[model samples]
Target: MKHLAALNKYFWKYRFRLLAGLVFVVLSNYFSVLAPLITKYVVNKLMLLLSPGTTHAFHESVQDPLARVLINRIDRWNFSNVVALCGVTLLVLALLRGLFMFFMRQTIIVMSRHIEFDQKNEVYQHYQRLDTTFYRSHSTGDLMNRITEDVSRVRMFTGPAIMYLVNLLALIGLSVYYMLKDNVALTLYTLAPLPLLAVTIYFVNQLIHKKSERIQALLSDLTTNAQQSYSGIRVIKSFVQEKAMLAFFRNSSEEYKTNALGLAKVEAIYFPAMSFVVGISTLLTILIGGFMYIRDPQSMTFGTLTEFVLFINMLMFPVSAIGSVASMTQRAAASQKRLNEFLRLQPEIRDKPKATPKVIAGDLHFDHVSFTYSHTGIKALTDFDLHIRKGQKVAIIGRTGSGKTTVAQLLLRMFDPDQGAVKVDGTDIRDITLKSLREQISYVPQDVFLFSDTVRGNILFGNPVATMDQVRQAAKQAVVDGEIAGFAEGYDTMIGERGVTLSGGQKQRVSIARALIKDPRVIVMDDCLSAVDARTEREIIGQLYEYLQDKTAIIITHRIFSLFQFDQVVVLDDGHIIERGTHDSLLEAGGYYADLYARQRERDERPSEEEVTQEK
Candidate 1:
């Protein structure tokens, strides 16, 4: 219940619609209570005509002058006409009640939908603003469930649960007022079961809240398992572990089912218990009213007793709905708590209050920078120092785990250094806005990720405002324009999820094209061309060199490309710079760089089995 306080803003936001819905609830209940009153009037009038002796007594008993006059007019009317008028009146009341009920749903339920939309967008925007560390710690499926399933539960509280609660209050208030006005003792007796009903609901709701939290957690796990299975289906199939994965999925599903059934069992008892209590109230009304009437013949009439019975029955739905409303409220509270867990979290990285955007000129420096991954406790960079002047082509060459990629990550400000500062254009990267810093640096990571969109759309993702001509030119620079043009729909062809529709080399080329389309002052390619053959790699590098001559380029890769001479080459090993010089000078010095370049060149020169077979 406390967790649900977060939604107060949304409630206030849609206050007008809620206010109108409240009015409708009252109007609907008002007309609904009238049915019982009308029935009482018809019964009493019919009784008077049937027994002529009671007509004079009924007129004497009526205290109100207006009611007396109305009764006299009704008594003089024809018997059939009187029945027809009551029937018509009940029909009209039913219509009016239904119309207001419809309007109640229109206003309240629609407002819930609007709130749902706003909440989802709010969560998604927060997700985007959070730093990389947050994403690394959270699973995609769990994040998705919070926004989708959890938000939906909250919507039930905002819409149906709230509406029903208001309806229940209105119906009970009106019904009790009318019942008590007729007879106090009988009304008190009729409501005797309600306190006990409330106590039962309170205990049951506690159990339900506990169960709902567990169920939501299990559902998130189940969804995560399914999502992971779908995303990694290719790996499962390739490894021939289909049965193993299926068995794991079945186990998760079974656990979820068992817990859900446990919750269902609890909820199953709740409704029947509610109905039983309401039933007791109805039975008490009849028995108590009968005794009261027996004490004195004129004390309570059959028409009044029938009216009391109808009022209890009118309250039956709302009262019985207590179980459902309580359950929904508990579930919503549980879900809102889950939402608040993420919503209340402040992102690890955010623009400082006074931080202003600055234009980056690509004069990069890593001054005694050191960083260790908090999750893994692995130091990726150790007092790493480097400097690159504006418009310089610097290639950082290293083997795997040599921290080559860390350089690119630092330059892009994905994570702040623990010990030192990264600067762009002689300004500490932290001094400028994160958006401004990231926008100027185009980083094509080793693991290329592409959205499920058209080839042109994926390319345009780097720069949404890039012209089609610019897109084609960027693709050409990456040497992927020819491959894209070969597709059936050319640029419009949908590249499946993560560019699965394309081959490894083709995907890498497209990723490079995406980076190129940014046209940033600093471009970092972290082994983005590892998939392409040497010939295509050379062509891409040649075209990129021409296109990026004015912009700073930092190429992080294990392989040494001898096609073009770079301005500087830094060799890294075990989070330290082992060698640093131009490619020719490093090869002349015969250090780690020289050895790596030699081995790579040897592998490249080695002939394939196909070539030997062709010679034979």
Candidate 2:
């Protein structure tokens, strides 16, 4: 309930609709209560007409002049006429009740749907704003469940649960007021079972809250298992572990089933319990009203007893709904609590209040920067320092886990350093807006990611305003224009998820084209060419050299591109810089860079086994 308070603003947003719905609830209940009173009037009139001898006495017993006139007119009417009148009146009341009920649902339920839409958008937008660290700590399944399933539960509370709750209160207040007006003692007895019913509901709801929380948690786990299994289906098939995966999923499903059944068993008690309470109220109304009538016929009439019984029966549906409303409320509370957990989380990285957008010239510098992953507690960079002037091309070559990617990440401001600052154009990056910083720098990661879209669309993502000619030109520079042209639809061909429809080298080249399309001041290619063969790689380097001459480029890779002359070459090892000089100077020094270049050149010079077999 406390967590559900987060939706207060949405409720306030739709306050007018909710207020209209409330008025309809009251109007609907008013008509509903009128039917029982009309039935009482009809029954009393029928009795007077049937007993002709007592007709005069009934008229004499009526003290009010208004009632006397009404009774006399009803007495003159025929039996069939009286029956028809009562039927018509009840029908009209039912029609009115149904109309208002429709309006009630229209306002309340529709508002709930609007709130659901807004809440989902809020969660998704927050997810987008969150830092990478948050994503690393959370699973995709759980995130999906919160926005979808949890929001749906909250919607039930906002719409149906609230509507029914209002309906129950309106019906009870009207029915009880009329019952007491007719006879106090009988009304008290008729309502005696209600207090016990309330107590029962209270205890039952506590159990329901606990069980509902467990069920929601289990459902999230189940959804996560299914999502993970689907995403990793290829891996499972490759490993021949389908059976093992199925067994794991089956275990989770069985546990969820057991808990769900337990909750159902608990919920199953509510209806019977409610029915039994209602039955007791009905029995009390009959017995007590009969005794009071027998003791004094004038004090309690037959019509009065029928009316009291009708009131009790009218309360049955609302009383029965109490358990269900409570169940929904509990479930909604549990879900709202889960939703609040993520909604309240502030992203680790955000622009300062006074930060302003600025155009960048790509004079990048890492001054005594050090960073360790909080999740893994592994120091990736230690006092790492570098300086790249504008329009300079630098290559950082290192083995795996040598902090090569960390430089790109820091430059992009994905994670701020713990010690030193990253600067662009003599300004600390933290002072610049994230959108501005990222827009000027294009990054092509080692692991390329592509949307399930046309090849043209994926390339245009880097610059939505770029022309088709620019897209083709960028692809040509990346050496993927020929491969794309060979496709049946050329640039319009739809790629599978993560570009599964394309080969590994094709995906990397497509990513390179995406980066190139941006025409950014700074382009960081982090081992993006690893998937392509040496020949293709050299061809791409040849094309990129001219295109990147005016742009600042930082190429991070393990392999050295001997053909591409870089202004500066850096050798990194174990989070420290081992060498920094021109490629020729590093080669002359005969250090780690020299050794690595030697090995790669030797491997390239060696002939393939297939070529030797062809020679034989």
Candidate 3:
């Protein structure tokens, strides 16, 4: 019921259709009750037809002599007429039942589809707004399960659960009404076990709900395992750990199986116990009616007894349906909990009241900024101060964990800083809308990632409306134009999932081209040239300087050779700035940069000089 309560808004929107379906159900139930009366007439008529002189015996079973006379006068002794009446009743009941079932299904399906559509979209949109902090803590497969499998469970609850429960209630009400009309004493006797049946359902659902939640959680774990294995298939093969991966998957699957079996066991016990109650009610009805018939034949008519049995028979399906719907409702309740947990989360980054969309000129300044992750409590950046005037090329160098990428992320507004401010064109980035800030900056990460799409599409991703000439020009600037032309279809060649079809260097170049096409005011290249050879890095940098003469650029790298071309260099250590100067000035100071440069120059000369002297 709680799960159903969450879905009430969607249910209300189409309540009219539900009402129409219910009206059909009421009509269908009434016709079904009439069906047993027609059946009773057919049975009694058949008995009378075979034994023509037994009309007096049939009448003697009635309580009142006037009622017996009335029945006797109405009992036409014709086989065809009785058969025709039974056939017409069966046809009418079948038609009404079929029509009601169709409408019920239609309404339920429409409701579930609309609900699922809205729910999925809402979840996806929420996921989009959530910061990297959430993603780093959760797996892709877990999110996928929340969006797909969990939502499907909600659909099952709304669709089949609604259909069955509504029809079951109608069936029970009609059956009870007809049973009482036939014989009040027998009807009361038949209902003796109903309260126990209800109690069984309630507890069984409690157990089912607990186990179902566990099973769904285990299923998410299994999905996570499978997704990780597939995404890291190359790593698995390289490490020769296929057996280990298989063992992990097998364990996850076994856990899921055990939980599912536990759920199945609950169902197995609930239904049999529920059915026993139904059987007991049926047996009691028969015993009571038979005794009443034998001791006081005038108390009941054969037709009335037959109709009572038929009505009880109709009650069986709805009663059994209650057990089944109970199981579905429990599963839906568990799924609802998962969906609500995800939906209730607010994004770590929120827009300000004065946030407005404004185009960026990419003049960035970091003013005594500091940040720490919420969980780790370790500062990624501490009182970091730097500035990049418009159209300046600034290279950042640092050891691992020196907060190199944090600068780029802050510029993109991935997460707001805990202290100080990051501004672009004299406007605090936090005050600008996230979309507008991102539109003016392009980031190419060290570990390049590309979508499963054509090369042209990947290149134009940053500027989807860019012309083909613009895409080609950006590709050429990244020095990948010749390589793209070598492909069978050139820029039309499709990169496989996550760009697996391309080599490491090729992927980096493609991503670079993607950023280049954006023609962004600020371009952030985070160690993007690491994979390429030194000579190629120089060539790319040459082309980059020429192409980006009027744009601000942030280059993060470790190569001392690559450090010489920047308009200014900023060196970081332990999340603190250690050096900020031109290349020659830092070298003359004979500090950290001087030591790194002299070591690199010695390594390059020693190998080359020996090779040359041997050749001479």
Quote the RMSD, in angstroms, for model 2.
2.5
| lDDT values for all models | 0.88, 0.90, 0.83
What TM-score does each of the candidates earn? 0.97, 0.95, 0.92
lDDT of 2 by residue, 28-127 (tens): 9988988777677777766766765653243343333543455566667787887786688689889999999999999999999999999999999999
Predicted model with the maximum lDDT? 2
Candidate 1 shows a clash count of 0
Who is ahead in TM-score, 2 or 3? 2
Q: Give candidate 2's TM-score.
A: 0.95
Among all windows of 10 consecutive residues in model 1, the one with the lowest summed lDDT is 55-64
Q: Whose TM-score is greatest here?
A: 1
Better of 1 and 2 by TM-score: 1
Q: Is candidate 1 or candidate 3 better by TM-score?
A: 1
Pull out the clashing pairs in model 2.
Answer: none
Worst 10 residues of 3 by lDDT: 59-68
lDDT of 1 by residue, 1-616 (tens): 7999999999999999999999999999988988877677777777777877764354344433544555567666887887887788789989999999999999999999999999999988988888889989988788889999999999999999999999999999988987787778888999999899989998999999999999999888988999998989899899999999999999989998998999899999999998899899889988888888778657787778888899988888898899999999999999999999988888767777877899888899999999898889988989899999999999999889989998888888888899999988888888899988888889899999999999999999999999999999999999999988999999999999888889999999888999999989999999988899888998988998798889999999988878766888999888999899998899899999889888998898899888889999
